[model samples]
Target: GRPLRVHSTEDGPLRAYRVYHSSWLRAAVVAVTFSHLLLALIEPRAGDGESYYTSFGSRANEPPDAVRAGLGRDVLWAELVMLLLYAADNMLKVYAVGWGNFFSVAAYSASSMFKTEKWDVLRIALVFAFLVEVIVALSTDVAWRPLRFLRPLFIVSYFREVRRWVAVCVKMIPKVFEMFLFILVVIGLYAVLGNLLFFKSGFYADEELQNFDTIGHSLVSVFVLLSSENYPTIMNPAFFRPDHTGSVWYGLYFFSFLLIGLFCLSNLLVPILYQAFKHHRQRLALKNHVRERRALLAAFQELDQNRNGLVTLARFTDLVVRLRPDIKKGDEDAATIAR
Candidate 1:
């Protein structure tokens, strides 16, 4: 017998060992790929048949059979694309873990399994799901839009820890209402007093002034006092002659109510307006911060190669090194490259 010769590259024993070991892996890859392709084919069947190719083909004059065939082809193509995407996604999951880790693998596997089950009850389930999602999303958006505009103010309030301050203000609302009621009561009191003293014929007959002999005349007297108008005409007997004596006490009482009601009540609105203005300013600042942060994030993401969330120091260094080569070649000027 000739001497047995062995080649270094040929591992007869190991090759036989690998045949058994690699078989399951190769089978899984092929199975996943095929399943993905099938899923893709099925997905396009769900399309509305308004794809670009379908639209293009419809423009031409053709027999019914040809047009129908073309439409079918488009549907099949879309389904195939979807299936490929599905298969690729599944294959990546399978590659990440061996079949022995079935429990862990099951998590990623559920999407395809759920989708398959969903298709069985798709008509009713999909319609309901879509409607529910749309309604919920729209409702949330409607609720959020106004609040989003007021976010800056809300944040400022939070930062200042002003809930207690707001509570205090809220507590004062009833007191403010009571004060308003008091002002109304004072005005009514004066209106009635003036009507009795000036408008009644019996009261006016004894007074020297004949001017204050009507309801209209008494109302004018009350208006002048409420406005803090202290003209001597208000006290003259010609103004309220026959009905009653014009006392200095009337002017003093009317002026007191005017000062309390008009001046003090109007000043109360200042704090409310100040709070609103503060919130507006805070909101503008927050919006500017968000815009700036978004721009910075977009710039960083543009340079991210792997699409992982973080921009690493290594990635930054690599980008700088790559730019240096371009600089050396004068492909980009320093000023332009800086941007």
Candidate 2:
């Protein structure tokens, strides 16, 4: 065999072959360009509401309609881009790799677009929408079997950029876990103090500590009070009892602590929980991903006969025999194999 020359130039044929031959790379370019165009067209019309769509609203009384309308527009544009990419990908596969391979490659390419920022919104949405049209078109049913093979190809799209993102997230996971544990500790402390000082045996027992029975009970009550809009009503009657000065002081202290622990602490935990949940889910996904990659690597290694890192049929048969010890050598020889 002639020596295979490597090129360093960006526009080299090898680079071009990798780019054009890769369904994912092509889909990503298309998906991102289309998403940006769609976002640019729709974002200005969203006005100040665009900011609200990306972040949780600070204002408690903000109308649902305003929020929903803003979110709906962004969602619509995202879906539009996804649909366009799906159609383009299908068409390209049909033209390049025949109808039989179209579903598989298109499914793979669509999965690959998840790594691109332009299509990331759609990708995240798809996680929640797996039972819906997008995944069904890509991965479910006999008609979509080819799509299953392409699923692994999507990982390639993430190789360069996602590694960096994963690295940052990996570094932050321990810190986030520590913060979450700290919040849990604070909640535990509050429960213990609230029970011992206020609920268990105190002067304000009848009023301030009416419903609470134990430390656990008081903690539940505190959680309820913090979450409720009727907290002010509950507090006013208990704290203002003219007969007990102790009740007044206890109420004031409880209310102050409740505000800090429930409102402030709970709100802070929201983002931490979000990040932790994301990290855990991604960890599970990464584990499964590694397993799949290992299987493919094993298959490739088996194909490399003569221990030369080059694939051939003889090595593949040896690997098959190694994998299936139950089959006799005669049966293995009789098995029809593809080149």
Candidate 3:
């Protein structure tokens, strides 16, 4: 259902969408989500993520009956019901967001909500959630079921920090790419050094040192070495063997690798994330500060209740009670029931 639009003046434009704005709706979303999460934590089904990836091809010929017997059927039905509700909720949001000029075909309908700038994240999320819902709903495979969890973006929207964190991370994308390029260059240089000092030195004549046999192998080996995965075993032959870089150069080579590969390039992420977070938080703070300038005025507009130009005290109190329901509490019973 369309929410009653609030405007300061009779002929003024509508303010914001309020279809999904009720506290009851918020509580329903939180309640349903936690129920599903609790069910998911305890219920183990046959077609989970690991089983799907590892056994899908092999089990392609297996009958549906063979996959699960009793309890899985119950879980599957519950999941389908939830997924349908999720899809329905997304459809309601589409209507809530977009304005339709039913009087004129010149104006777009519900789909036109995407054109507006303010609700871009919610718009993208609506489409993505619906798509995941449909895909999961049609398929019996439980692996795709995990995608249904993303339908809660609307719930998470109440916490603005998620959006702030996303904005900061989006700003860091270029900086991250720059760091990646530098790391690749360092890895490439070390790969060439491995090719020259080990493979070219005839270390590959022994099968034990075959990892350094080619430039590709040398590149991968350098990556493994930098990660410190089985480091001593992978590099000990090159270090101790007199035919290669030798014991004398071991400390200098590995130390330089650590200094360049692990320490220097990796540390850049810390400052970049910090800087992005700081800038985003400042932007949100300033935006909120500007919005607060119009706070009482906007509240008065909403409080007008009737389409009249000015608000009386009674209408003002009604709007406050409507907006903040906590003030409606009368006794311990009311408070407990509210909780």
Candidate 4:
């Protein structure tokens, strides 16, 4: 039995990839991003900011009055224009690549348009914020407008070094969290000890409100003392009584806590984080290097057409000319690299 099928006509993915990577399109996005940031800087603050519209009725049938005024009017118009431009840019990419490819939810790879662009999440958020702004415009509320301040994040994708730095920071999150938890535990223990030892002391009782009367207060006092803030004043009551005589061991407790918590444990976190950053960066560099070697190997294999594991100089030159038609065959400068 013969099977009959109908084929659907659609733009090819290769063509879509080409269009999305067009230089002019990228340049336009950069220009718009810069303009958006510039406008954000001068954008008026809330309560201090003015609105271009006013609402007179609570009914849905009543539309807001469009009486434009102040710097807000121009800023609002510019924002709307930028929104439209951003939307158009995104739409063009979507139209070329189809909706699924343009708004991918899968893991990142070279072929995924959304992941490669690195702005899908932020751009989608920006679009939603625009919609919210329009809905809230009638009531003259612009609380969500400050989200535009994140516009500079879009520019980070343009720089490879910046992206690498961001990736390193992201990778450090878990380790940083663990270290923070460890520090909190150490502080908690110190707080409990301080509460037990100092609760009945003259130091805690002299204050209008007892600082070390309970675990909670002791925790706050110890944390504050960690910063060495007026520590001598705090240590005085424990150091010397009204008769100028007290046990030296009272002062020793504060000194020991400062030594272990402030100088030792707190400073230990720095070298640990530095090591983590260094390791992640080295791993990233290795991954990139391997990828480059694999690509070069694949290119070499393609050049060795006869499968002899070696490419003739003539063959290499011909392949180069074939790959880039603009490079004329007889150009020695272009062919020299084939050697």
Mind sharing the TM-score for model 1?
Answer: 0.28
Give one digit per residue, the lDDT tens place, for model 1 in 142-168: 111111122122222322335445544
Q: Determine which window of 10 residues in candidate 2 has minimal summed lDDT.
A: 1-10
Whose lDDT is higher: candidate 3's or candidate 4's?
A: 4
For all candidates in order, the CA lDDT equals 0.44, 0.49, 0.57, 0.65
For each of the candidates, the C-alpha root-mean-square deviation to the true structure, in angstroms, is 24.4, 16.2, 8.0, 8.3
For lDDT, candidate 1 versus 3, the one ahead is 3
> Which residue runs does candidate 4 get wrong by more than 4 Å?
1-40, 47-69, 84-146, 149-152, 176-178, 197-217, 229-249, 302-308, 311-326
For model 2, residues 1-339, the per-residue Cα lDDT tens digits are 111122222334334434444677666855554453354343322223233233223343464355654654555446555555544543442344333332334435523311123233333343234225334432321122122233222342324355445655677768577776766676567667666665544433555443355776666656656566545643554566566545555666677767886778778867876776677668868976875776667657746646787776555565556445555545645254423
RMSD of 3: 8.0
Model 1 regions lying over 4 Å from their true place: 1-244, 302-305, 308-339
Compose the digit string of candidate 4's lDDT tens values, residues 214-251: 88787777787777776665666777678775666666
- Which clashing pairs does model 4 show? none
Q: Give per-model TM-scores.
A: 0.28, 0.32, 0.61, 0.67
Model 2 ranges off by over 4 Å: 1-217, 226-234, 240-251, 281-289, 307-309, 312-339
Question: How many clashing residue pairs are found in candidate 2?
Answer: 2
